[model samples]
Target chain A: MPAERRARPADAAKVQRWLDVVAALLRRSPDRLTFVELAEQVPAYGRGLRSRGDERWQESAVARMWERDKDELRALGVPIGVYPDAGGNRSRYGLETHEFYLPFVHSLDGTPARRTGGPPGVSMVAFSPEELAMIRRAAGRAAQLGDPAVADAARRAMASVAHDLAAFDPDADHGETVVGQPLDPTVLRTVGDALVKGRRIRCRYRSMHRDVTASRTLEPLGLVFQLGHWYVVARDPGDERLKTFRASRMSAVESLAPNGAVAPPRGFALAAHAASREAWELGDGEAVTVRLSVAVHIALGDLPGAAPASAAVGPRARTRAATMQVRRLEPFLRWLLAFGGEVRPTAPRHVVQAFRDLAARTAATYGAGS
Target chain B: MSAVARFARLLRLLPKVADGTPRRIGDVAKALRVPAALVREDLQSLAERVEDTSGGFIEGVQVLLDRDHVTVRSRWFRRPLGLSADERAAVALGLAMLAQEGPAESVPAIQRAREKLGRLGPGDAAVRAGRIGPAAPRTAVAGAQRETRYLAALQQAWVARREVELAYRKPGARAAEPRVVRPWRLVSARGAWFLIAEDAARRAARVFRLDRIDGVRLRSATYEVPAGFAVEDVLRDGRVFMGAGAGTLEVRYGPAIARWIAEREPHERQPDGSIVVQYPLADDAWAVRHVLRYGPDAEVLAPARIRELVLAVLRRMV
Candidate 1:
């Protein structure tokens, strides 16, 4: 077995400094401390100042270090507040006591005596046992999503919950099991991180219809896991149009920024884009409404964006008539063809002709001419 | 892990062990979902003293680490940290997915949990951005709802160790058949649910697709799962279908859909730009439907019986 890579001494000391800084801030909560005061509280910030030849560089480095520490803590949901002084140079930072800590979670059935003023820096939230169990099951299910980004986030969320609960046994079984879909963990993680951080990504995407791989830059807005696949709903900066790219088809996904340098367009609703769309409606072609004779048992509403059409009599009397808008004809044809004789496209002359041609071509492939 | 990540973990870890109670390192590691050695390293770092501005050492937290167990005495960070934005979003998405795919009865509880987590409320940016919540709209797909209903009932039966008689309609069958089985486990694979159970009549384990089950009637008789039986034992090949005599199926995809097919599962690329895959074939009717779904994009390459079945379906369709 390969040896474990231990943490360097310098890294350990840096972590210790961070711990000390957080301790100082929490100890003096609700009281703002300037950078000078914080430096006093965390001695490591001023250490080796005299030994360095570049005093000015060392001072700026210390300032940058302080800024980094604050950003890191805020990222961990520490709720560190900053108040700039009148001079606009000296900023006082402090921890928001109420927001820093998790609320006291209790079972709804328990009716403990309420203190007129509970302990300082503490609040409460109540949930039933079944509710808590559901949350636990949800976390477990999320961990099995086959997406590393989601799994890590789920683990962190559950850890926080476990910390607040007394006598929390992590080994307790939740009676839920999942066989997650096989997905590219790297692509999922990269795309997910970019979406969460609101960053742009450059990737090589293999387009299925065109059967060509092309490099493109995208501003990732949201992630959707549907139909046993993960998709990134993003916008091409060049066109400023929303497109959904299957996560598995993306390769070499590289984030363009260190932080969230870009934000989604104003008033853009991701739900509208993330809604379960049929294969045919996902294309960029001109809209074509194709009338179909669908089996009565198949609900039109369930077909996603389908509307009832005027029924025809005679041979098609038993089947209901429906019309659905199609952006890509091939996928629409394939979808209708999949239902075999149960569904038939009877619409504008071209659509019916195209359907026949496809069927004939398919039959020809099996040595049966149309 | 990077030092910053380690720092964040240490912040969370301090609250876990700072209650002045002795906790086994292994137990703490398991609870934190981290390696035991990493836990030990964090504890060691916490035990070290830091120099204050006045040339004096300040002991933030006192740690008592021994061979197997460790305890900490600290007045700092005794409370757990609140969930970060990303973490909250993740939890919200989990609840949302469960709301969509879990048992129907759990919806209310799932909703309550979401409300408590400050999600799903009006004007929530995360919800607006579609970062967290159900990916699909809540339009009830009859087939999906039916599967969830059967899944809920089967789950209860499995937990109670009760035998269930399923009105299961096999593929291509016109009528449902009654099958008595002892429920063992409910597993989801490839976006579908299946029941890994023991067939009482055959006295052997079988896998049943939840959608194909017309109805589930709980039987009064209870049965114990065999000691040596494991879900993996039946699903060793990673294929959910467990027909009596399964064979390997070879199919080739046309160039047009080859890239799409390659994205889904493993396949070998042919020089002609097509792709060939060996799939597990258990039911002839399933193979026919699978090929029919792809239309002419897919062709049965080997296994003449399966090829014949595909041709037969194509002939009927044409």
Candidate 2:
């Protein structure tokens, strides 16, 4: 193989990273890039080496890099062509960003997108000193007990209040006790770590449905804090299945030896499995597909791209689509109902029927008509 | 089903319509390529909804025909509002947690919510004197969001019963080429995200990491997730993340490290304030870094060979 071809594998990511930087820059500025200027503008290249004191690019290498960039641009199928601006030795690269740039326009203004627009005529309420302290202290504690993201949010909210205390005008209302929770570093870090690493962990888990403490070797897959408690998607070793464990109920934990050394079956994916009905099961079982629909409102939030990928926007919306698969059906539907009518099953007619049947049962218990 | 419906069907969309600007009916019609009347009908249906617990009617829907504008608004109240200080704190923490999504338009939301809440209180410095909890390190939240997206995508694909094609890179692999496969499930253990899926090319369910999936695609074909397949069971049967252990490994933990260990369950804790851990001697390597996290607080106690390994690590660290 030629030197260019031989070195292709090693240089691809650097090339791609460079290309990403270039693309981002082009998308932002949409101007030509001089070789020297390119080096100065690209983040990786721009960070250091301002002077280009010891620049090393062979004539052949520069040609190769150009060819690679050309191929990459062609792959995008846009009419991106480089022109030697003036002399053969000098060149400027340019691409029309209108084709590639994503126009992200804010639909609303900076004013509060208030989901809960407090009572009309209620500009603000005032709290007593004791109430204010209680609210701040409570928020701090809640942040500590929750996930890192939530804790961070709580911290920011409190900080904003503290920073703008004069603006808040605490005297608006007096003697009103404000409730809050502080962030708990211990629990947040623990679940955070488990979710980041695809490792099976042991925890003294407590379930909301039952107050009993049980030791569980769990493969934590996801974490969500809802209704004042943290929930973890863990693969329980005892029964060999995934279950949502409440972090608040977890009294203690005892790590164990890594699960035995065996390979997961061919084509086995936890995400795919979680989407399957089988994922809801806390016991070992086969995978099943669980189809459901989210109401348009919930859909925006739950569907892909509603919130920034970096935000804790509930569960991550699957770009591929919204359906869920798992090892069992019952648990998945139970969680689905948390959204009430906002979500409905479209496939596995049996699953939908089951949900309907359960709803009917619930309605009957309350003596309500369908 | 059409690809749009098929995609929608596979992944359920649960509407979470909190108070926000409703998309213009005309815009929805244009995007979906439907008639204005049809779009208006859909909007009307949506506006008629009184499904929430509050049972309030949807009002304030503004459709300006002349301006070709549309907006939906509803004034509904959620109940059980008298939150205790603890509950208020939890909500505040949840709001703080919202910051992890990155600085989106939501920053304004946080500010507004704070302002609204602040206005409810007196401006007395002493009244608002208590310190707010320390903010989580920004890097931590950013990292979690990045990881969660990959995990969520993998999980969504698995749940949708749709095949996933991914370009994966494994550690120590000479190449970082794209590898396509059908993703089945995602699991996170030890602060790392792993995807367990079937490698279409290999025809086997292989374990991959979220950080390693360079590209992900949902195949069109519907898959039949075997009624009895569970991702958790597969991992427990020693199928995921554990390759054949290559060598004996041992480590010790001090009190300072024990709490995190207890949190992570790296080993079984004994009543005597000690913990014991074991590893197979064939499939796992390149995990030395993970073992060393305990630092001097950990010492390898069992298996002379593994003990020596721990010592070597300590020596290197020293």
Candidate 3:
């Protein structure tokens, strides 16, 4: 399968549960399924199975209901194939691609930067009139350059600041303690240059976890603002590896000239390497092939080459009769690992063995191994 | 294929009068890289496309040639094809947006350019309509709210000139931390709001995330906003938190990897278009990991340090 599959996740529990039922249906029915029939069999979290006679359902409702059904199927690692029927009959819907594809949707599992709460030891400070004017101008300029409606909204909010400046009494005991002071201008400018020029920057960094100090050269690439603090997307030249560093963690910065090399692309774009984690990165390196037997729990019966979408799989049916070829192994492994033993890693013995060994090792460590 | 194509061919060739100018049929043909016979056959057809109206349109279409050179001189008039209404609205909106970003002084130049386009009516009506500026909607009410926030912080900072306490959260970090910092100038980097301040405890400049700031309060102390505090310096300080880290990496290439790299331009291109290129990286692990993704197609070449790291990682995985 394409590595792009890893980009979409059963990122949320709602979707993850949906995938489980879909996978079960695919395992049982490998052929094409009518939308209604598939949705009937797919389980719902809080509701008991509905009778096929339930007249409350509409085609649009069926369509909407399948989103969760499909999401859950993907989470369980079942591929649901869809195709246009060649017979031209109105009732026939064929399965097209052999493998299942989950549409590209933004996962709800936001990164750590998105979590709420201010930086430690700090209290909220409202913007002043002059500062609001600057913010409005700044946000407007930013929107004009690239960002869309959100930037415009920011500008609108900035412009709303009332001019009557009220003095904030520091000792008035607002019942909140300030965490850190405003950053000096000199440092922000220096860091901005390093990022723009993609040059090596030398800086005095203080580790947050421990009392340690060190000077290091960083190849700056990108910057991200999340959860109310500045963070640099830099690679440590010493290690030549990428890592996110907090702005507050640094003690000082020493600027350096560009090394004449063009900087790598970064920012918020999906294509940017920063957006993907290391596991996804691994699958991109080399493509590996794996073979798997469809479990009875999957609804592969609806697949064109397979059986019907509603084929029943009784527990005693027993034989491991189906198999498939998968190209990328890392993401598959990660996804399969999350399934525990429900979906077995069948082949490329190395991969299967690796999974087995890992499980064994963990079990032994926990004194639960046979 | 047609008289039109032949005429276009001749007009395009007029620029290459490389040596001394030649005005004869042969010179024009030679300049155009075409046979003289072909040039002669197309001259009439080409003349028709070069309009000089009032009947003078066709008259000016005639080309004058002398032993020294060939010159195209004419008082030609052609009907204008204007822009549609939607296009005009789009242009007006775009211009208004552009005006917002640039210095106020540039607005006049924009107006003048619009006037010139209008006078040159040879273009579409939409193009002409674009000359008139689109009025921007008012946002004074919301602007007041934003001002209240900015001023409140500014006044607090001004009073303390000493470090104002800030709460900041760096993205991707497991959690946010507390830091004491002296407030400096607040600016926007790209689109995000940022506060440039000095770390009072560390005695170094740093940037704070305005949104992540849960709290802010001024202390009873005073310190200058530091005359030498350059915005760029603080940005660099903030950058360290951005890049993964810098390290050297060695990539080895097999024939397939070499060909793939060559075709895709995956790495930076050298003037020679060689298969391999190297540089200092902020995120060495990321680079090495990325290179490894190419699988058997590429290899990691020395400095042996990176190779050892990759090997060590793979060994642990295996």
Q: Provide the overall lDDT of each model, using Cα atoms, as 2-decimal numbers.
A: 0.70, 0.42, 0.40
Ranking by DockQ: 1, 2, 3
- Lowest summed lDDT window (length 10), candidate 3 chain B: B138-147
Error of model 3, residue B276, in angstroms: 3.8
* Best by the lDDT measure: 1
Q: Could you report the DockQ of all the candidates, in the order they appear?
A: 0.34, 0.02, 0.01
Cα error, residue A241 of model 2, in Å, equals: 43
lDDT of 2 by residue, A133-235 (tens): 3345435444444355454444433433332133333122211111212334465566554443344567776543353567766666555543233555566
Identify the superior model by TM-score, candidate 1 or candidate 3. 1
The TM-score values for the models, in the order shown, are 0.82, 0.29, 0.25
Clashing pairs in 1: none
Ranking by lDDT: 1, 2, 3
For model 2, the stretches where C-alpha displacement exceeds 4 angstroms are A1-370, B1-146, B234-249, B254-256, B266-274, B279-286, B296-318
Winner on DockQ between 2 and 3 is 2
Q: RMSD of candidate 1 to the true fold?
A: 5.6
Task: Estimate the TM-score for candidate 3.
Answer: 0.25
